[model samples]
Target: MKLAVIGAGAVGSSVVELASDHGHSVTAFADSSSAVIDSAGVDTAAVLDRKRTDGVVGGGAPEDALSAEYDVLVEATPTTLGDAEPGFGHIQAALERDRHAVLANKGPVAERYADVRALERESEGSVLFEATVGGAMPILSTIDDFDPSHITAVRGVLNGTANFILSRMATEGLDYEHVLAEAQDLGVAEADPTFDVDGTDAALKGVIIANVLSDDETEYTLDDAEVTGIQEISGSALELARADGRTVRLIAEVVEGSVRVGPRLVPDNAPLAVSGTRNIAQLETEHAGQLNISGRGAGGPETASAVLADIGRL
Candidate 1:
């Protein structure tokens, strides 16, 4: 299959490498950073190392560099709904040309899932976004197999950075700032960790998951959901968790016609207690009860795995 990878950042680079490794033809890498399209192919490791060393992050507009038609197009950009317009444009273009789309970016699906769904329907092309919500956790496929009517609620630690910070605060009694610094140093948190720390990232994921699980005819928006960030909590909250024999987690939930995102104190026996870094999402459903899906949450390799999975489906 000929593949076009949009957004050559962390996740995009990984998808390109994985597809190339599987012997798929990676035609072009569209990013705002650099426009290096080697028709003969480029060394994945060398390109990634150069990107890291030179800080060549954030690709250029997708419209400028992405002109080739491929069997599949992978969108793997940062979690910026505003900047995702170009990626969406690329998806639309690919679909117009009757190409399949596999999205690792959350913004497009979160902000315009219904529209995109319609476009895919009109184009009669497939669109998959397994990496958006749980990363390698496979939440979409799990829900896809089950009956949506039986789903009563969905909740878990959806943001890995917030969970890592909370875990550090709870386990080591570290302050929020200290834990955040650690997360940044370890690359678990972005330099601008506002979205992850502020709960918007997880809220976006929740919106996408809700849309995927909802009846296709039902219209739902995240405007009504209450969102709260982990930045509001302090070491005092960690103390409360210790006193109550629980840990604080940034939990996003959709239950009983209401959606909420905030930090909550969960018991030590809770499935979220085992989450670390980018580890797990414990989804609660009516029929399945509680399902624990764990794996690498954020990284090129994991995201690449998801893109390849979508390709396989195609």
Candidate 2:
């Protein structure tokens, strides 16, 4: 497949870098301001290096990549809330032309899933967003394989930054501010981690899961999710939970038509209690019982792998 990748951030750059390894070629690549489009594949190495040095993918206009020839549009733009614009518009362009779209952006699917599906229903194109929920963990595909109907509920530690802060607080007997500072220094948490630590990121993933499980009878957005962050957690609270042989994690629960993400106590030995930067999704199946999928949930190549996998499925 030939891919037109938008958004020159970590995930998009990774997709451009690794696409060739997966037996796919990138015909077009773009950041916010520029793009490089070629019918015959673009030079991935030069483009990436130029981006590193110059901070732009190519000299061409970003819109050029949208109209460029490609089998699939890899929408890896940063996840935006509300209307999910630019990214949503990009996906709409691909589907309007009857071309496939594979997403690493959570905005379009998390906020406008029903609209995306409605567009897909009217076009020859199809949309797949395995990277939107869990990076490299195959959560969405697992749900699809089992048939969403067969999966009773989904819950897990979906945010790595929040998990890292919480787990470090419990293990090191540190306060929330201290652990959060360490996490930021280590690049485990972003400079502005409001979304990650405030449970918005986990809620977006939960909302995506809910949208999937609803199967079109219902449509969910972030507004529908009940969210809580780990900002107010204190050292004493961690010590208390530790004394009780339990740990707190930011758990996202999608069950019985509701999506909730908040800090919750779990047994230290439980699978949901995974530590530092690791993520786990536990699925309750109707007959097959519980299934746990765990791995690095956020990173460039880790997430790009899921994006390319979706292209393969396409």
Identify the leading candidate in terms of TM-score.
Answer: 2
Model 1, residue pairs in steric clash: 31-59, 31-60, 32-59, 32-60, 33-59, 33-60
C-alpha lDDT score of every prediction, in listed order? 0.76, 0.94
Task: Give lDDT tens digits, candidate 2, residues 1-314.
Answer: 99999999999999999999999899999999999998899999999999999998888999999999999999999999999998999999999999999999999999999999999998899999999887999999999999999999999999999999999899999889998899999989899999999999999999999999997999999999999999988889888989999999999999988999999999999999999999999999999999999999999999999998899888
Runs in model 2 with CA error above 4 Å? none
Give the per-residue lDDT digits (tens) of candidate 1, residues 1-314: 87777787778887866776787877667667554454565456666676778755324444544666567888876666743576688778878877889998887777777778888988967899888877777777787777766667788777888888988888888899999999999988889999899888888877887787674765445565689999978898788877988878888887765668998888977777755776566666776677778777767788778778778878
RMSD of each: 2.7, 0.6
Cα error, candidate 1, residue 234 (Å): 1.9
Candidate 1 global TM-score: 0.90
